[model samples]
Target: MGLDFSVVPEYAHFLWIGVVWTTVLTVSAALLAFFGGILFAMIVLYAPRLLAWPTRFFVWLFMGTPLLLQLYLIYFGLSQVGIDVPALVAGIVGLGLHFAVYNADVIRAGIVAVDPGQNEGARSLGLSRAQSFRYVIIPQAVRSVTPPLGNNLIALLKDSALVSVLGVAELVHASQLAISETYRPFEFYITAAALYYLLNLLLEAGLRAVERKVEATR
Candidate 1:
């Protein structure tokens, strides 16, 4: 069949809905992962061995598995056990939890990249360890950690497509529905790809701006 985009207008609303959900899911998951990662990294770095071991295992569990499977466990598996969750909630939580491990590693590395002498200097100034970590260490780590965090944000954006499996109506799902109705897979799929590319361009631009601002402070 000849390439045809005539059906696009009829399903533009579908794609738009997909765009909205993709943005919402990415932002929510990114926030959860970023902050959750900070907490997890702290536990890994400072907690007693007993606590740290289990936290590490939790991170490993999430990181090692397929995220789509994680979504199934959270959305379908939990419901089977009498804990019902909406698809949107499941999508956000699954993506957040899965990525938080990588963020933990990124953050942990960033924290350690701050010189040991800096920590000792903060302590010699009579700052408590916690105060030093909060005031001196974290600020320095933030500058080093930002680029990797931005890269992960892009991965998170692309992976948001997986949420369609949970029936969350993200970009892929919308494209699938349009393809089913119109039998024009190329047109819809290419449109979806183009939309994702545009979103990535915007995200990359934002990341660049952030990196420039962070660099200005150094």
Candidate 2:
């Protein structure tokens, strides 16, 4: 069938709403995953054996599985156990948990990359372990991990498409609906892809600005 551009103007508003939801999901999931990753990294690095083992297992379980399966388990499988979660909530949680595992590794590597001497110097100043980590270690680690975190943010934005399966009405889901209604899959999907590309470009620019600002402080 010949491609039709006419549907573009008619369905632009519908797709715009999808873009907003996609942005919301991506931001919310990124923030949730980032903080969770920090906590997981801390637990793996400093917690006692009992706590560390479980935390490591949590990371392994999520990291080893496909994210699409994770989303299904949360959104659909949970309903089987009489625990009903909203589609959007499930999508956010699933994405957050899945990416948090990777984020934990990035954060942990950043923490490890910081020189041991720095922590020793902090301790020599009579700082407690917690204080040394807070004042000396975390600052350095955050700077080291900023780029990886930015990359993860972009990945999260793209992965947000998976949530469309749950009927979350994000970009991909909206595109699917539009195509089904108008039989113009190419037009809608291409538009969705372009929007995603535009978002990633903006995200990359913002990340570069943040990276420069962080470097200035160093």
Q: For candidate 2, write residues 1-218 as lDDT tens digits.
A: 68888888898888998999999999889989998988899999999999999999999999889999999999999999999999999999999988888999999999999999999999999999999988899889989889989998899999999999999999999899888889888999989999999999999999999999999998
Off by over 4 Å in 1: 121-128
- Tens-place lDDT digits, model 1, residues 1-218: 78999899999999999999999999999999998888899899989999999999999998889998999999999999999999999999999988888999999999888899999999999999999988999888878999999999999999999999989999999999999999999999999999999999999999999999999999
Q: How does model 2 score by TM-score?
A: 0.95
Pairs with backbone N, CA or C atoms under 3 Å apart (clashes), candidate 2 = none
Name every residue pair that clashes in candidate 1.
Answer: none
Model 2, global lDDT: 0.93
Q: Which parts of model 2 are misplaced by more than 4 Å?
A: 124-127
All candidates' TM-scores? 0.94, 0.95
Question: What's the C-alpha lDDT at position 88 in model 2?
Answer: 96
